[model samples]
Each structure stands twice: as C-alpha cells, then as structure tokens.
Target chain A: MTVELLDRKLLFVTGKGGVGKTTIAASLALLAAQQGRRTLVGEVDAKGNLADFFEVGPTAFKEREVSRNLWAMSMSTEDSLKEYLSLQLKIPLVARLGPLARTFDFVANAAPGVKEILTIGKFVWEVREHHYDLVVVDASATGHIIGQLAAPQSIQELVQVGLVRDQTDWMLDILGDPTRTGAVIVAAPEEMPVNETLELVTRLRDETVVDLAAVVANRVLPELFTRREEKIFERLPAAALAQAIGGPVQPLLDGAQLAVTLRRTRGVHLARLRRELPPEVPLLYVPYLFQRSHGARATHQVAEHLQEELT
Target chain B: MAAKKNPAANTRSIEQLVAAKEIVIHCGSGGVGKTTTAAAVAAMAAVHHGGKVLVLTVDPARRLANALGLEAFGNSETQVPPAAFVKAGVEPRGELWVAMLDTKQSWDDLVTRHAPDRKTRESILANPLYQNITGRFVQSHDYIAMERLHEIHAAGTYDLIVVDTPPTRNAIDFLEAPERMADFFSSRLLRWLTVPSRSRVFSLASRPFYSVADRVLGSKFLEDIAEFFLLFQSMYDGFVERATAVNRTLEDKRTTFVVVSTLEAAPVHEAEFFIAALEQRGLHLGAVVLNKVLPSSFLEKGTTASARAMVSGAESLAGAVPASVGSPELVARVLREVGESFLNFQVVAKREADTRADLSTVPEVVATVPYFDRDITDLAGLLELGEQLWR
Candidate 1:
C-alpha cells in the first residue's frame, strides 16, 4: 500500500527551493527502476544536476541513460515547442520560420503557463507513447510549478478546438487521473520550508486535479541517544559536559551538544509537521545525512531507504 | 616575514554598496537566501546607516513581505511600520518602504499612465491574451518588476532601494524579458498584427502571414491579439521609453547588482551563470554575497589536526578498562561524534570556499554570511542576520 508512487504512470516531484527536492525525485526514480520499471527522470528546468549526481555528463533535451534501468533528461520549453510545432504544422522546421515561430511564441509570451504546458505536453506524449514504465518530473519549486501543473486546464479553456485542444485535453486527462498521475511535495524539517510545503499542498489540492500523493520529509535527524541519555546530555552545558563526561573529552561532548541542539530543532519541527498534515497524506522521513557531499552515494542511500520504508 | 598583502584587497563588502549605491539589486539562484539578504541589507541601511530604504521583493511566497512585518505588499509601495524598527529597538533617521510586485496591477498601472484614454485601457486590460500575460504568465513579472522599480526610482522618493530579483523559474529568460518586450512593442510585425479588421489598408499588404494566422489559429485568438495590440499602438512608444530608461538605470553607476548564492554546488553554478550573464549584458557585477555559507574559520588546519589527535587519544584512553567509571564508552562515542562534526563542518566549509573561488574570474568582493540554526522570521531576526552580514 505504501509503494503507491511506483504504481502510477506519471509522478511529479516538487517542493520549495533547496529542500532536497531533486534528491527525492532522483531517489524515487531509482526506486521505480529497482522495482523493475524502466523509468525516465525528467528535469523541467534548464538548471539541472542529474548528470553531476549520476556522475555522467550533462543531460540535454534528449533523454540519456544515467543509471541502469533509468534514463534522465532536462527538458527545455523552447525545444519542446520546436519539436511540437515541427510535428503539428507538418513543416520540416516550423520553429525556424520567424513568422510561424511568432505564432507559437505568442502562446509562450502572451499566454499564461503555455511554456509549462509545452513541457508537460512532451511528457504526456512520452507517457502516451508508452516509451517508459514511469516518467518522473523534477519540476521547479512549489511556488512556480503549481502554475505549470494547472496550465493544461487553462489552455483547455483558451483553445476551443483543433489539434491544440485535443492535446490539452490529453494532458488534462492524464494529470486528472489519480491512478495514472499524482505528485509528492518534498519538505525539510524546518519552519519556512514546511510552511511553504503546507501552503503548496492546500493550493495544489484546490487548484489542480492531480492527487496530493505524499510528503517526502528530507534530511530528518534521527534521535541518536536514548531518552535517558539525551536528558542527561541535554541538561549539561557544553562546559559542564566537558568535565562531567571527563577524560579530556570536553571537545567531543561540546560537539555532541551541537548535534543534539540541531536534532532538537528538527524534533520540534517534525512533531509540528505530523500534527498539521492530514493523515491521508503519508509522511516519508528521509534520514538526515550529516556528511557534506550531496553526491550519488547520498542520493542512492535515500533511494534505498525509500525502498526499505515502502517495503 | 611572509609577503605582506593589501588589507583592503577584499574590503568591498555588500554593506558598503548599501551606503554607496542608490539602487542595489540582489540576483541569485533560487533558495540561496536572496530575499533574506535583500531584506537584511535594507534593514541595515535603514537602521544603522539611517538612509531612506525601500525593499521590493519579487517573492511570490511573500516571505520577505512577512519578514518585514507587512501583512503583504502590493504593486504600490507601502512604508514598513516605523514601529517595527522601534520594536526591534532601533530608531531610524529615514523611512523604510516595502512592496511586492503585482504583475497584473502593475501592468494595468503602466497602461493607465501611458494609454491615451479610458476606452483603450479597458479593451487592452480585458483582452484574453493580455489577461493571460498580465495575470499568470511566468516571465511577465520580470520586466514589469523592473518597470515599477524604475518608476519608483524616477520619483526620487528614497535614498536606496533593495530589490530581490523574483525566482520566476526562468530567471535568465525573465531578465531578458524587457528586450523581448521592447522587440515585440517596436516590431513592424506586431504593428501588422495590430491592424484593425475594419480597415482593409494593410490587410492586403500583410495577407500572407495575417490570413495564415487567422486561418490557423481561428479568428478569435487573432482578433483578441490584434485588438490587444491595436490598443497598445498608442502606448508603444511609452512602453519602449520605459524599457530604455530601465536599462539605463540598470547600467547607471549609482546602481549595483549583487549576486547571492548558497554553498551548494547547484546554486553556486547558477550564481556564476548569473554573474556571467550580467557581464554579457554589459552590466558590471559589483559584489557576490555567498549566503548560508558554512563558517570555515571554525576548524583551521591547526585546530583540525589537534581535534583529530584529541579524538584518537580519547579512543585509546576510553579503550582502557574503565576504573568503575560511569561510562567510558559514552566518552569515546561522544569524542568520535564531536570529531566527526568538526570534520563534517570542515568539508562543508571547503565546499563553500570552492563555490566562492569559482567567482574569482569576476573581480568582485565575496560577502560570506554564516548559515543559521533557524529561519529569520521577523525584523529582529533579520537584524541579527544583518549583524552577521556586515560583520
């Protein structure tokens, strides 16, 4: 029951900036791949780190294999529109023509969310074509990506007929289907990110047809010591701990205190998060990695944790 | 003695720009604490330097709006409660103002000011294409955000204005939006697009493209777009004028652009990209503020070596049978964790420094602000961050 994300054909991973949203998206893709699903991880924005994280060269508009059973792409709205127009207008290079491009460009510039629609439409095509078992989108942060998700519906209202309306309807149908498509909101165990995540959930629930799947609580600090040990450690000030802990171990005790303080903050926030979010929206707490690097190993560790948790 | 270096080599902090420049625009990758840095700089200039400061944040979340103690700001500037400063125990010699860019309202204001009459404004505002662009479009906020800043700057109402460039998702495209805007407004193609169907004058001249677009997209979209442009026909020069003026303000000596970033590899890369983009656009990059950067001085080489030695010694000492001591294992474990934390902080610091080192090609002073344990929620918190910023 918990491995619901893997059952879906399309999964959108989004949250606030710097909250390890990309890490979670990568992990989810890995988890899908491990479950024997041929997965494609797509980054909607131009600024992407999929290549770096996978220790591969940069990905572009075209999908490239980053790992076993997994492929990655960083989609550009421009390239998407170019491909779209070339296909739709039946012209070899419709996007190259200044006048025809202007007609296509009008939607990008003057229409709200058309650029987003283009990007999503490309994914919709991949999903429709059944090229991959799952397509995971590393969308822009919560604030902007919400509008991107909603663009299909609004475009449906704007374009009343022809191939454009049919395409918009196709995207909307896929997005609205709970079993086919859903999105997870990733958050950090802190005030601002949590606040934004909560706001995003409510707004998304209200505005879009996509199901609010779950919340990925990234970088959650684990309680290292027992309750009794933590109390004894917590009561001692850094200086006192240095002496009481003894044996010239003052520096270590002081460092342990810092770690405790950080976890204490996380503990407080994590509790508040549980109390606030509805029980239906499952909370998946990714272990907080204390190390500095956010490389391939860290990403896969979280992926493994995700797999283990769902199991 | 080791070779002497210039003391003022890196003396150009962002705080100095607050005092020196009339306008300070903070540009950065998303989640690099750009809005907080902008607010911190504004509060410092308002309270410490006693300059009249206004902060215009493009944050859609209104995080800065909340931090500045405003419920929320609108297109028009709202003076931050001087009481907010007083509550923080700081008296300001000059006033502080804050605003959030409302794209639709600001665009309406632009039309209201430049449009010839009420009828034209109403039609343009009501047009579906215009409605979409003004309301929910992505990069539309960029040029409009700067336009309002230009409008406010021209009024000479404040000594310094701090702008947090909106995370419009496509920041580079947004930054270039005004040019896209100017091109659209000034283009003969748009003028052709604007031709009223009631007149047959240019209908024959532009039949090839016009008829094709009308046939392809249907009369409704073309009609709405053409009518929207027709209304803007009178106001096109005004739009172009404002764009040029804004670009001039951007290029002016009194205006400074500050690039903000966190220590993370992704953000650092984007910050470098931003700096290069600014340079490519003929805009001089003034200062780079690496925000949320880990403190490197905490564990210098000497401290690191000694801490490692101390931890290893403790492991050996704790390995010896405890003489009925309450928990020698606890001491060893604590020592290891402490050593680990120090080593962790060292790695974090080096990563942060490497990010800043990437900015070396651009000759700008790096202002490094330490990562905090909690969010800067209010003016008091912001003031504390300001101390860290200027420190």
Candidate 2:
C-alpha cells in the first residue's frame, strides 16, 4: 500500500510503553532530516534517550544540534518555567525565590496536565518558531498521549487568563487543525501493543477530531520458515530431539521452534491489527531489527525504512 | 499552633501521620490520582501545619507536573502557585518543595561528589562502559533516584518528605535502590576489575593467550577502566560509606515506606509484590493509598450496558467463550468480576497493611476520584483534582 504521509509540521508518535515509540519517532525525524528537511526530535519524558540514540550523552530542554540538519531535546518543566518566568514575568530567577521556587516545583511536578501542557506548549513554540521543517514528538504511551493532547482544552476551561489562556487556545488551534498536525500510533506486532493501539485509535476518534495519519506496526517478524520446513520440524523424532537437545542439532531445532512461535504470534497480532485499524488509516509495518537499537547506526537504519513510508 | 482539625479530610489519621513527618508514599496504577494525592498531602503538611515538605516522584508520565500545576519540572526545586492555595483557604505556613528524579544526572552528581578527586571524576566520566551503564540501564537510574532521595532527606531542608514512588510495577526498583547500589559497590567482580595492573599481571602469568587477546581487542579497553578507576578513586570510600549510611537510614523506623495501589487487579498485584519486597528489605510500610477506587454504587450496577452487550455479542457469534475478549468495556467488566470473585486481591493487600507494625491502621481507602470524562491538564484541573482528593 503506497500511501504518502501528508506533509505535516508536527508528527505525534505515541504507543504503549516499551513499544519502540521513541526509536520510531527518532527514525521519522532522522528520515525527514535526511530528506534535507530541517528536523527536531523532542522527548516529553525527561529521560532524553534521543541524545543516546544520536550518540550524545544528554540534550538539555533547549534544542541542541545533533547532526547537520537534526536537533534534539528533552522537555524540562523547570527549564520551561524559567523560560516562561523570564519571558512573561520578566523576572530573572525571582520567581524561584525563597520558598516560592520550591513551592512552584512541587506544584508543577504534582499537577496533572501541567507537564503535558508544557511539553506540548514547547512543541507548539518550536513549530511556530519555524526552526525545523518537522517537529516530531516522542509522546508518552498511547493512553497518556491522548490525555496529554486533551490537556490544552481541559486547561482552557479552567485558567481563562491572559497568557495561560492564550497559550492554551493557540495549542488547541494547532492540534485541532489536521493540516498542521498529524498523529501516528506506533505499536509492536504483539497482542498487547496492537490491542492498545486499536483502543488508542478508537479513543482518539471519539475524543478529539485530530487526524490519526497512520499506525506503525513495529518489530514485525518476517516470514522465514515455509510450510514444508514446519512439517520437517514436526516430523523430527521426539526421542532423538530430546536426547540430542544438548548438541548443535538441538540448538538448530530450538531456533526453528522459536522462529515458528514468533511467526505464529506475529501472524495473530497482524491479523488483529488489520481487523481493528480504521480502513482509512494507513498501516506501516517496520521489521524487527535483530541488532539492539542503542546508538546512531541502528537509528539510521530505522530512518531508512521510515523514509519510504513517510514519503 | 494547635492542629487544625477537619473531619472532611479523606484520611485524617493518615493525615496526622503525614503531618507528623511520617514517610507517606502515594502509589497506584497509572492514570489514577496517585501523584496528585501525594502532592496534596505534602501541600497540606507544608501549608496547614507549618511543616516544610519535599515531594519526590518517579512517574515518567509527568502526572506530578499536572498535579502541581506546573508546565514542567526538573531535578531542581520549583515554586508552587500560592494563589490557588490561598483561594482554597489553605494557609501558607511552612514551605513546599518538589524535585523530579533525573536518574542519570543524579548518578553523575553522586559520582562527582563521591569521587576521591578531579582525576578520578574525569576517568569515570571518560569510561564508555560507565557512561553506557549509567545512561541506558533502567536499574541504574532507579538506584541513583533512591540515592538522591536519601541525600535530600539528609540535607534536612524539609520537616516532612512525601515520596510519590514509581508505579507499583517499578516500585521494587525504587525500594531496593540503596541496597542495589551498595551491592554494586561491594561486588567482588567490580573490585577485581578495578585493579587493572594486578589483573593484567595475573592474566599474563595465568593465561597468556587471554591477556594477549584482551590487548588485541583494544588498548582503550584497559585505558577506559584505568581512567574510570582514577576518576572514581577519590569517592570509592565515600560512596561505599554513604551507601552504608543510606542503607541504615532506609532500615530505620523513622523512614516510612508508603505503598500506593488502585482497587484494580494489576495494581493490587503490584502492591502485593511491593509490600513483600519492602518487608524483605526490612523497611516499614507506612500507609497504602488506594487511588481511583470505583464507588460502591458503580460496582453494584453489575456491568455497564456496553459490557453486557459485548458479552452477548461474543455469545451470539461463537456459541462459546471467544478466543479472546479484547474490548475496553470487557476489560473493565473482567476487572470488576475479578474484584468480586475471590476478593483475595484486596484481602491480601489489607492483610499486608495490617501486619505492618509501624502503621496504626490497615489499608484505608482515602479519596476515591471518579473517572472524569475529560483529560486532566493544567493548574485548574489539578485544583479540581485537589478538591476531589480533599473532599
């Protein structure tokens, strides 16, 4: 299915925790940058794994150049507050004064939506600043991302103030516009992530009017065994297999069985993914990279795969 | 000032313990009001009782930021909005502080602080393995977070400290962080690895081929270790000593460990494991905050119409139990059904809570926030959340 992902200013990637959303989001950003488009990859959680993937230690909340056309950052609420305070209040660290700064940190860290709103606010700022051709948000898990995206509207009803209200309104306008923002759900080709992704798609459809551009089925198992190869494994004498299990032949059998088990699991998950996903939403499947996705090399490989899909 | 009494407070007894500077932990399943409840309790202590409070959270979902009404938080302390507190009629007596655990940064800070000297710090920072281990390993991060908690407590900046522990799933890591760090420091293998000259001399004599193979791998491999040891040399003694102190502090009765759980099965199971883990570590379980508990009214309704329809739809289609029941409504119904079946989950949670000697009561259902149809974001949402929690 050759579906061209729409040209979007923002691509929001979210999935269940541990579903490779960050890796895929980085890949998408890298792919855009490789295509000669200036790109920024932002991680909402303060983990800053993006820098690690880029082979750097850690990027601050402020965007730092990673490559020729790529930049990365991990959003920090304290830094954002400092920026907000400095920009809005025109007070240099006075807001962080005795007792006041501590109190603010406590409240900011504890408040629900404050992190999401700030993270999103930062993304909106980056988008408006036009510093990058593409701004990719490595959002929290699917359920939380939905909550995070809904934050602006939720806060707008409450604050109704000067800057906070205006910021909320501006974010809402950007997120609500399909042309401006595109949300992609990333999932492993496993039961839990795929099931959660379907639920996420349904929830997004129900709650917000934003466009869910595609579903990226990550870590999909490629079909390596034929039906005849499966028959041969089945026909292997049980006694011989059990007796020789400690030898080289046993290891090969074990590998074959693992491949078969993985294939079966992948088949079931793929079928469900196809059935559950909205027909209109394009499904992009990324093969599982056998190598650990830690440094720049693996990220670049994943980006190569994403280039075709994004285009 | 006399303790301002309020019967309407969700957990008056719990609040009393919290106000007394007891270690109150707010934990639960994700999406529940665990973070918010923790923040409110800390706020209550700081604002009402004239007690300085520090709140520590490891919720990567950034729920604490939402609860505190801040745009974002870092490892550093930031201020809370005073207007909301004053408007809510809560007095500002003592101070409230917050820090989001940045595990890597904290670990680096610890390394820098504990390292014997500048050379040792530089060596440790230069080691690739050390960087990879600290930066990427989840366990390493959790251990550093715990180390930071101990440091903050020892600093004596706050009269009361409220720890919003990581979710129950990762609760074990947070609870055992000190011990893990201690074990890592004391590991025999690490000790052997640090003595490169001795290792190289011994390897060359005992296994010449292996030593030659090691040299072939890379000269930098040994250099990395030498640099690491040098950088970390100054702080080795201090790090081990501090780890011992932190371990002792954790084992003390004054250090309260609060287990947070939801009424749901997954969180309940997680809470059970957490309690067991804490007991094994010789830490006291102070209180269990059961968050997002469904009101008896909702549970009594048996199943929602949608859930009933799903069951019927399965029955009609398969004429038997379907291969899988995978709908949100079904998941909810199943959770409810599980809650009703053995009641074993809550029974075990309550039993565990009761067995804790330091705590005055078993698990108490403090505040039960109903599921709001809308998403919770911003300061107003958090204040609304505070109202729900305090109500």
Candidate 3:
C-alpha cells in the first residue's frame, strides 16, 4: 500500500520559485505536527522567510521547537558538513576543520554535486536516525531540485570508493522508496507554472529516485458562476443595475468579470495539469485566500485547507 | 536624489532609457515576468526606435519562445520574423532578435575562446566534472549568462540589448558572479585543493584538510577533482581577464537595470532589495517596471459600499432585474457571489496598494502594467505589455 503523504519519513517539497513552495512545505509540516507526528521542517534555501510562516524567530542550522511536536531549522551547508563530519566521520575537532568549512561553499561550487549532496545527506540522515516522524524540506526550486535530489546517485557515480560512497547506498534506499520518501510539487494554476510543473514531473522521474507524492495546486481561484448564471451575468444591463443598486456598479461588475476571466484562463492550464499528471499522483488544491495578511494566520488557513484536501 | 537633481529627468521613460543605453537588464525575483518584460521592451525598441534590437532571455514560457521563433535552445540569435510584427499590426522600424541562454553551450564557447590550446579546450570539454558543473550548478548559469551578454555586447551588433538575468538563489548572485569568478581563480583554496595533484606535497597547513577530504571523498575522487582544477588553471590568465572585462561592462555607463515585479509582498520585497543592491554598486537604475498590477479601480472610492450593498440586498436587488436575465433565486445567488468576489479581491488589491506604497527609493520611471487577462502568447500580446512601459 502507498503511504499517505503525512506518513512519509522524508518529504522534499519543491516547485518553481514564487509558487508558494515554502507555504506548502510549512503547512504540510504544520499539519503533520498537529496530527501528532513529530515533524521537522527545514528551509533549504535559507531565505529566512520560513520562520515567518509560523511567526517564529529566525531559524539556524540548529533545530528549534516552534510548537508542540514541531520544529524548524534553516539548512546551512557548512553546518551540515560539520554535523556530517562529527556524527558520521567521528571528527571531533570542529576548530581544526573550521577553515575547511569556511571554504566549503567554494569547494561545493567547484565540485558541482558536493553542496547538493551535503544538503540532501543531512535530511536523509535525520530520517535514517528516526529523529523526526516526518522531515518536510522546503527544498530548492524546480530549476535546481533535480540536481539536489539526485546528488547521492551523482556522487556515487563520481566517487569510486569512499565513506561518502558507502553512505549513498542508504540514502538511495531511503529516498528511492515510495513509502519512506516522496516529493511534493507545489504549483500555481497558471500557464508558465503549469508548464514548469509538467516539465519538473518528467525531470523528477528521469533524474531523481524520489517518487512524486503529491501535486499541490496553490492559489486556485474559485469558480465564479454556473453556466446559466454566467449567461445571466453577461446579459445584465450595466447602467440599469447601477441605478437600482444606488452605488456605482461598474467596478463591482468589472471585478466579477475580471475574476471570471482569470478563472477561465487559469482553468485551461489546470485542466492540462490534471490530465497530464500521472493517474496515481494525487492533486490537492488550496484556494486563493483573499486576505490582507500572510504569516502564521495564513499558514493556519492553508493547513486547514490542506487537511480538507488530504482527508 | 538623482531624479531630484535633474527635475526634468523625472519624466524619463523606459523608451528614452533604452534609446540612450546600450544594455538594459530586466532583473527581479523569479516568476515576476522578467522574460516577458525584457522581450516586450525589446519589441518596443524595434518598433519605435528602428535599430537592431535583441532580447537575450534566460527562461521564457514555451509559447512565448515559439512566438519569438526560439523553438530550440542555443546561444544563436534568431530574428523574430517581420511577418510576426505585421501580424501583430505593427511595422517595425528596425529588427527584433531573440536568443535563449543555453548554459552548457555557452560554457563550451567560453572554454573554446579562453583555452590556450586545442588539446586543453578538448580536455576541459571532455572532463566529467566540467560537464556536470556546466550542466547542473546554479552559479554556472549566472556566470555564463553574464559572459554571453558581454560577448554579444562587445560584438556591437544590436542597437539595444535587453537581458533577462537567470533566476539566481540570491538575486545578487549574478551581479557579483563575474567578480566572484575572478576571485575563485586567485583564491588560495584552489591552490590548496590542487596541491596534491601538482607535486604530491601535503604541507602542514593543508594536511588536515586533505586528511578529512580524503577520508570522506576518498583519495581517488580528490585526485580527479585536483586534476580538473590543475587543468582549469592552465587558462587562468584568460579567464581572469575575461571575468574582469565582464565586471567592467556591468558597471559601464551605457548599461542600466530595469527592476520588474508584481505588487505582491514577496516580489515587492525583492524589488526593494534589488534596487538597493544596484544603488550600492553604483550601477544605473534606469527604471522599475511593475508588472501584473491590479487595476486601481479595485481601490477606488466607495467600491466597498457597493459590494456590501449587493451582498446584503441581493434578494431585493435580484427582484429589480428583468425576467429575461434569470430566475430570481439564481439571480440573487449570482449577485451575492459577485459581491463576495469583489470584496475578496478588494482585500488583496488594498494589500497590493499598501505594498506598492512601501516601495522605498524607487527609480525615476516607475511604470505599472495592469494584469493581463491572458498570457502573452504572440507578438500582439507582447506589444500590448510593452505599450504600458513605453510612456
């Protein structure tokens, strides 16, 4: 049986930038924590905005509990490398390794997959050690996510024999399994985002071992009118309606018209996404919350909506 | 402050900026329509100014790519057909060209140009790590894009070149990539990492690092990377000279940056950050193109009262409608829905307005483009977008 999304040990949530990838990842972890699972959510890019979702203070590499059964941290490759050295390699002297860690980003930049491997390795280690029931990663955007998720396999091919090579086997076993780990792609129901989502799905299948757990269509606008009502909406006399309403009604009507046009335009892409995504991949939707604020409150709303979709 | 210095310069539009500058780079956080804005501006330049215009975009939507005749990826520039302009009901005074940045191909070209010998060039191209770096690493995209832009600009083919920067992890990464590239070649760490491969001499200072690296990555992998870097060092002088030239081009007086963003919170925040970065670097801040802005009508006087009236009085309002429209019950439902929808959108529009107001230290020309109802698939749609920024 396929494990439910929340039940997975490791979940890397990624999507195109600006598609609410962080929002979805935050809410998924929030929901899992509320469901009584010990959850850890790591923001991979460290934009420091993930803390805003919970209205908490800024996060560091060290995990902090934001609420009951929930923790948050920001991934730093240097810190991840330090942790890997001490925990896995039994390197106790961080001071001696300090200079090496300082230049880690440069090495990673030159070595291609080194940084990606370190990032993924930390999360996989968390799952392997059973530190958290669920580790939801606000992973890299779609452009770089495949490289990150496939880092272990790439490293395996590059390194003939090493401790890193030995470690890749377990990381692959955990990541490649559908039950323990999966990827959630959060997409907005728009043309470019939908196209990117479809492209990423193919890339994930071809490039990474991670299974697609879910596709979250975020900020989906509501359907404004039924067929009969739409015809009625079109036929309404604008001038006459304003006179009857006792206020300028053009903007009001125009607003609805705009919404309808938006929904219609977006619906085409949504349909394409649904039709093209694999049949087994569950697609969940979170509506456009036309609120004035984003933060802890908005995250709660998103989590509630996700809960509804999941159930 | 600069705008204040030249009072008449307040009216300097994107058109004037493009005409005056050799390079106009459209940059912001991802998915804020940078590619479309750059393309639109280039199209506008071709139509009005009548010279060779090129838009070197990083990533564009598929249909927009098709519209521009960029059906495949490469560094090659293709002219957007004059027929497309005629179809869009515009006759260009000059020509519009398009190119998509293919990172791997551009890196190969860079290697070909900088390598001291054919064998070195061939070896660099064949290196497995080199292939992976060119293909997968994000920073490589930033460096190669700037490198490609410098090459094209130096060729002096286009009257105006509009560039869309890659969506970097940090928006400032690309801006600093050239300098960073130069620094990497001269850094001590590169020497340290490459030491073992050079003479098998492990100095005391580097011994601990080597020991740790060897244990984790194995000696063979280290040797492979050391060999790669040793090979890379052969062309260090040419690479550093090219990187320095790229940096100079970015700071050139003829270059300008157009910051594009929606009035959404995150994108607006990024725009603010980017504008500050540009100012800090002493680069020219030409204009700010605010894309996908909501209609000002949403925040107009007394729209809320009208919406509330519709919601509270839907049934009574429905009764006033003619029988030809719909049944009273359905009419009431539609009325309520419309009102609620308007109210919902008003909340967002108000928020957007506040965010727009929060944009501090904005450039002289801040052009706001209303959200297009449909994606810009053809030249007509692009021209429509361009018109908003032209004035």
Top DockQ prediction, candidate number: 3
Grade the docking of candidate 1: acceptable
lDDT-better candidate, 2 vs 3:
3
Q: Give the Å shift of residue A102 in candidate 3.
A: 3.8
Candidate 1 lDDT, B1-391, residue by residue in tens: 0122246646766677678889889887777788888888888888878767899988777777777788888777899898888888888777888888888888888989998888888888787767777776656788888888889899998999999987766556656766777987877667656666667444553644444444444566656667777778889888988888888888888988888878787777777778778877877566778776655554444556645754666556444424343366665564455566666656656766765676654655667777676667789999888887775
Model 1 lDDT per residue over A1-311, tens place: 34487888898899888888888988899889888899999988767687666777889998998878899999888778768766776766552455656665665554456677888888878888899999998987877777788888777667665456567777888898888888889988877688788888888888888888888898886565666445444443444333433433344444455556677877787888878888877888898775567788877899998987676
Model 3, range B25-94, lDDT digits (tens) per residue?
9999888888889989999999999999998988734435765644554469888888889989988999
lDDT of 1 at A200: 87
lDDT of 1 at B270: 79
lDDT (tens digit, per residue) of candidate 3 on A112-217: 6888988999999999999999999999988888889999888887888888888999999999999999999999999888989999999999988999999999
DockQ of all models, two decimals each: 0.35, 0.02, 0.70
Model 1, chain B only, scores a TM-score of: 0.88
For candidate 1, the lDDT comes to 0.75
The recovered share of true contacts, given per candidate in order, is 0.19, 0.00, 0.69
Write down the lDDT that model 2 would get.
0.60
Give the C-alpha miss distance for residue B340 in model 1, angstroms.
3.2
* Candidate of highest lDDT: 3
- In model 1, which regions exceed 4 Å deviation? A1-3, A86-104, A224-227, A230-255, A290-292, B1-9, B196-216, B302-332
lDDT of 2 by residue, B74-139 (tens): 888776767656655566787777788776688788877877668667777766656645653344
